[model samples]
Target: MLEIVAVPAFADNYLWLIHDPVSGETVAVDPGDSVPLLAEAERRGWPIGQVWNTHWHPDHSGGNEAVKQAGATVYAPASEAARIPGVDVALKEGDRVRIGEHQAEVWEVPGHTLGHIAYVLRDDGIAFVGDTLFAMGCGRLFEGTPQQMFESLQRIAALPADTRLYCAHEYTLSNARFAAAAEPANDAIAHRLKAVEQARQAGEMTVPTTVAEELQTNVFVRAHDPQDFARLRTSKDTFR
Candidate 1:
């Protein structure tokens, strides 16, 4: 089994460190800041051998150079290579990356960014989704259209029900609030909202959410069509 640790950075971002005991190989995913990420890896005695980025956003790829300098090979989206620093390997859709004995298939899940991608470890039933999909929400579509985002989210939703989606932010509380409003009649949303509220109050992480959970409570995923998704995405922009 892989040991995944969440290293929090920049108030809400989570930089993931994945360690495979069998191969003794470690990988850093979307490391925005190398300081904490490196420290945590050292503490665990897991030297980072690879850095995998999902996009070119500063907050997601800021530490690319630093991690690369520390002897880690950097892997970033081929389409956004110009924006990402120190990329040793440029990955595209259908590409495969390996850490120890585990393999991840690169999926083009553009939405949050025009070049955003996801790393899906199908055998492990895990996906590192970057900013494309959130706990009960979706990315803001900064460089992609609502139609693109809708399709990306639907693709993620089509994964196995038990697949664990590892999104990059800690936005579950606010998303849950909006989900409750988006589906006032949904008992699942109400129930999940209450749970998320309590989790946040207790300072607990509410991510690595399952596909099944999102299907039951995420309004964006439940949207009837691209038009409905667009409206929901527009509404969420200024939901407060």
Candidate 2:
């Protein structure tokens, strides 16, 4: 079985650790920092074999050098290989990254960044989507155009309804607030906001949101089309 644990890093970033219990092999994703990640590997007695980065952002690939020193093969999207430091393997869409006995499919999910990608583990029913799709919102268009981002969301929405999203940042509470503003009549979003607030108060994570739940409450996923998505995105950019 594959086990996933969240390693809180930076201010709100989450460095995810996925392991195959039987083989004691682990893969760390979007490691903003290495100290905490390396410590966790030692705590679990698992050898780090793979480090996957969804984008070339510093907060995502900052730990690449340190991880390489620990003997982990770092993989990043082929599009940003030139910008991603210490990338041992550059993967493209449709490429499979084997971890122990399982595999994760690389998907080109640009929008948050020009070369952003998502790693979908079908058998595990989880997808590490980086900043592309958040709990109730989507990433700000930093590199790709709004239309590109809308298409990216559509691709992710095509995944199984049961697919669990493992976003890199902990933005659920704030995103829900925006969702509430965009769809004031959405009782599902209001309910989720309350639940997420409680989870935060208890020092718990509100992540691994199901695709079904996002479809119901997430404005980005529920956007009618590219133009609608662009308008919502523009609103979010200046929400605060």
Candidate 3:
């Protein structure tokens, strides 16, 4: 089993650290900064050997060069190779990534960025969804269309409900608030918002939310169709 650790970085971002104790192999997901990640790894005595990139965002790939310099093999999205630096392997949809005895499937989920992708480790019932799918919201239509993002979200939601989603940002509290406003009739969203607020007040992280939880509370994923999804995206873009 891979032990997943949340390494907080650059404001609200999360750089996940995946460790397999049996083999003593460690991997980093979206490590935006090298200082904290390397320090934390040394502090915990877990030497990271691989770096995985979900997209080309600087905040997600800024540390790729440094991490690779430390002997870590860099794996990044094939389509975004030109944007991401120091990639040793270029991955695409349906690709398989292995760490120790654990393996994960690669999913090409564009919309937030033209070449965004996510890693689904079904064996561990976990997914490292960068900015594509948040706890109670989806990514903005930065480089792709609403239909593209909607389709990506639909594909993610179709995964096992028990799958625990690991998003890269700590924006669940604000997203939950939007969910409540977007769907006033959804009691589930209201309840979730209450809990999220409490957690934030107590300085607790609200990420690693389950697919089932998002299905019930995320307004974007709950969108009935592509057009509905587009409306929600626009409203969320300007939601205050």
Q: What is the C-alpha lDDT of each candidate?
A: 0.94, 0.91, 0.93
> In model 3, which residue pairs have backbone atoms overlapping below 3 Å?
none
Off-target runs (Cα >4 Å) in candidate 3 are none
lDDT preference between candidates 2 and 3, better one: 3
Give the per-residue lDDT of model 1 (tens digit) for 1-240.
998999999989999999999999999999999999999999999999999999999889999888888889999999999999999899999999998889999999987899999999999999999999999999998999888899999999999999999999999999998998989999999999999988899999999899999999999999999899999999999998
TM-scores, all models, native as reference: 0.99, 0.98, 0.99
lDDT of 2 by residue, 151-173 (tens): 99999988999999999989988
Clashing pairs in 1: none
> In what order do the candidates fall by TM-score, top score first?
1, 3, 2
Worst 10 residues of 2 by lDDT: 40-49
Model 1, TM vs. native: 0.99
Best-performing candidate as measured by lDDT: 1
